[model samples]
Target: MAVAGVSANRLELLTIADAVAREKNIDKEIVVEAIEEAIQKGAKSRYGAHHDIRAKIDIKSGEMALTRHVTVVADDWQPEDELEEFNDSAMVRLTDASKRDPEAFVGKEYIENLPPFEFGRVQTQMARQVVTGKVRDAERANQYEEFKDRVGEIVNGTVKRVEYGNTVVDLGRGEGIMRRNDSIPREVFNIGDRIRTYIYDVRAEAKGPQVMLSRSHPGFMAKLFAQEVPEVYDGVIEIRAAARDAGSRAKMAVLSNDSSIDPVGACVGMRGSRVQAVVAELQGEKIDIIQWNADEPTFIVNALAPAEVSKVVLDEEADRVEVVVPDEQLSLAIGRRGQNVRLASQLTGWQIDIITESQDSERRQREFSERTALFQEALDVDEVIAQLLVTEGFATVEDLAFVEPYEISDIEGFDEDTAEELQARARDFLDRQAAILDAKRVELGVQDEVMAVPGVTGAIAVALGEGGIKTVEDLADLATDEIRGGYEVKNGERTKVPGVLEAFNLAQEEAEMLILQARVAAGWIDASELPQPPEPEYEEELAEGEYDADAVFAAAPEGDEGEVVDDEVPAGDPDQPENA
Candidate 1:
């Protein structure tokens, strides 16, 4: 059949394939393959269905060829069930093929040429759809390959449109979307406006590749500073940590490798130009550039800058710190609605409790008196001896009971005889306390199963029984946090029971051990079992994406856990005005 413009035009085909490949950012070979497949399908439609059809395009000359392929098979070989139907068209017996070509042998393939035919309207439409679909699939694959590795990078794009609260950005070669929550607070962009955003995530979905962009991410601010500060970019200044409240406020802790250079000053730039540039980009978000310190107390003080801290008492077991300032600076340290202290906590990765100096002093004296009384009553000692024990850092009877005789004797004004006698009394008092607790546990009817759990002392068993957690099963069902710190509810004027850990003065690890033992005793877990958490799958290869200059600065070295310094600042004089 004769058809116009249906036969392969080598030059035009090659030119079209090249244009499409460049436009779609796909390999030219892929486009050529799609065209060849489309042509083969059209040829099959024109020729007899039984013909074995194949097609190829010459890369250099743009020549297209359609051929029928028949494989030579052994005469004794039987055709499979599915192959039996097309055996005559797809394959030829070696004996039969030898008649046509004397050199024909098994495994040899014979090719027959077919004249080019014109395409009908329907065939033309089918070919168009096939090429279009193949090109689209290739384009999507290319897009996924291009952007998958670009996650966590900052990219520039123009706003294409806004749907609901989400903004779509045209990234030249692709498109990205910034969800409403990922955008900085109160910041808006108009159509065609160019903007930079951090690529927090990229995923390949059935519809297309989804590039998630963010403007309020902590990494975004860190990257911005890297762009503005040469020292940060060059690795002389390192950003230890960053926390952002979006368009309101942010804090960054930085350290300098070179002693002569100040990290904060380097980030701030001459006359604050460098930081101002970053602030402008973030819509005037106030940023605090802190001098990072290895000493945690010093770091916290720097993080809560603009407000002076008179003292910081860290509770290492609880991972909490208490900061005391003058009464006048209380509001400043706490910030408006606690924003200052909250940012400080985030920056330092610790829980912070701010108090006035007077409040701290009162709490301190109360704790001292309680310790003194505890030592006096437990050791049958006078107030002077108890005071001495308390001042020597022995805050509880347990300390004296568990300590070596030499340790007690080392205390000022303590003779060996006196220390030995005190230790004996402390041990006797603990024994009496334990017996009383055991009696209480029995009275409360705590199960033997609960008592058998490791770390579940008689006192803890009694406390658990009073709280209505009687059986091993009940204890096993509690969450780690619930077991470590008991929940509390206050209604109008009534206060419910606090957590078991707080009630028994149990450490977090001790509570966890108790729960683990409970689980084992309840037959919920194996006796020798260890927790097997699923490991995170991370891509080890470096992504073919833009470099994140700030990422290097923000990457913290392992084993650099900041230490708490024992240094203390003098208490602020309430009568004197604070330093501005």
Candidate 2:
């Protein structure tokens, strides 16, 4: 150890540096850096700025000292409390001031000594505060030792505490924080819970080191498998990929290095002991062990298990699948609320739509029927006009006896000018055959299908027509309760009036008239808008041959199979009654 006469205790600085380096486990250079900074601060405080002062330290010898630069003066001034300009006015021989002349003069140059210091109580207190901070900084560096190289490694720790939804784990030498987002959902940890997680990342900070842990990382499952399977450790099996719905389900794709030793079997021990261990660690989260495949269809089939797929129509460009199965298997293949297909889609990164046999057939049949009906209906109005005209004996223009311009105009394709020309030429010929034709009323005899109701009248028919409620189709389209609310009947002391046309009272004739008008407006009685009449299911009869096709054909009659001639009317006649 070394000592100083008027400045420093030489051994003290060396001893302090050695102590800081050893206790904080840091390099001596760091402590030296701290000491150099401290001395510069102390020197500035002890010496005023008027003096140009400097300091040096010898770590090996543990010695420290200070020196001051002074300038000589020619005026009656000493190098004590005055500015350097006053000293500049003095002139003394520099060589004499260097030798300490007894009679010193102005304008001379020399150097003076500033003694080394042993820090006073105030300075020592400040130095100690700085040393404490520096040591903590050094310790922070040491704290990162275990975490810096351990990122992405598996670690287990006891839960120290929970704060602000973050779990703090005691990792023996240090603590790590498992943020709420980093934890698997629906999973909770207690104070003493022994939690296993992957080291996600590490960061060095001023206070200490921070290690981030995660349980939701997909790699955590893969790492856990490696720990349980020896083949995975020795490179005989590989985990191809893993997809997880954390805390609920996970699918892991694995393949074998040697095809003979099944990769899935190796990961799942003889009785599933290996995977069971992993499942227990994961708090009963289900694991699907899938065999990896280069062929996507086979992989998808494995991903969706227990539900057999009848066919898979893959759309490679869109990365989707249309899976079809038997009608009875639809619910099973779709699983409870489609959970099975959803998980399979997540695992395979594909969109899947599941369909049943009946649904597929119905879809195709609807398309075919619509296409055919559209083709036939496009130009078939001529047939309907021909049949109606034939019943009226408007079979030929000459049969009319006296052709009217309006009668010719009534024909759909005949123009007005053509009708006028034909009527003028054919009047006499048309009039001659008019008496031989049948009565117009007898030609069209279709009647109203509904029974007449009492108290109801044509007032309701006029109201229904004006209100756009003209038909059974319109009435059936409304809910029963909605229609019922529209009707009003007198109750006790109040006179009631119908809010809707459906509730009006009418006589039988009026009801018949209403029904006839409604049918004409709606185009049907039990309208198409009503619930469809169930088709006759002749499946059993047809299968059992209850009726022979040959006998049905033999029983059918022929020969005009027609009605009488009493109802025939003249051609181009306009007075025929309308029928439905």
- Report how far off residue 203 is in candidate 1 (Å): 2.9
| lDDT of each residue in 1-580, candidate 1, tens digit only | 1111347567888888898899888999998888877777787777766778988888889777789999999988775775465368879999899999999999999899878777887677778877888889888788778889988678999999999899999888889999999999888889999999998888889988888899999999998888889888899999999988888888888889999997777788777888889999999899987777876777777777778887777777678888878899899888888888998899999899988989978987999999998887787779998898888888778888888899989887778998889988998999999999988887888788788887787778888888778899999888766765544556655444456556666677667777877899999999788455567443344668855555654453322323333336422224321111
Reference-based TM-score of each model: 0.75, 0.48
Clashes of 1: 2
Q: After superposition, how far is residue 332 of candidate 1 from its true place, in Å?
A: 1.0
lDDT values, one for every candidate? 0.81, 0.61
Q: Tens digits of per-residue lDDT for model 2 on 24-76?
A: 67887677666665665565566654455555567688655565556554434
| Candidate 2, residue 559: how far the Cα is off, in Å | 66
Alpha-carbon RMSD, each predicted model: 9.6, 27.8
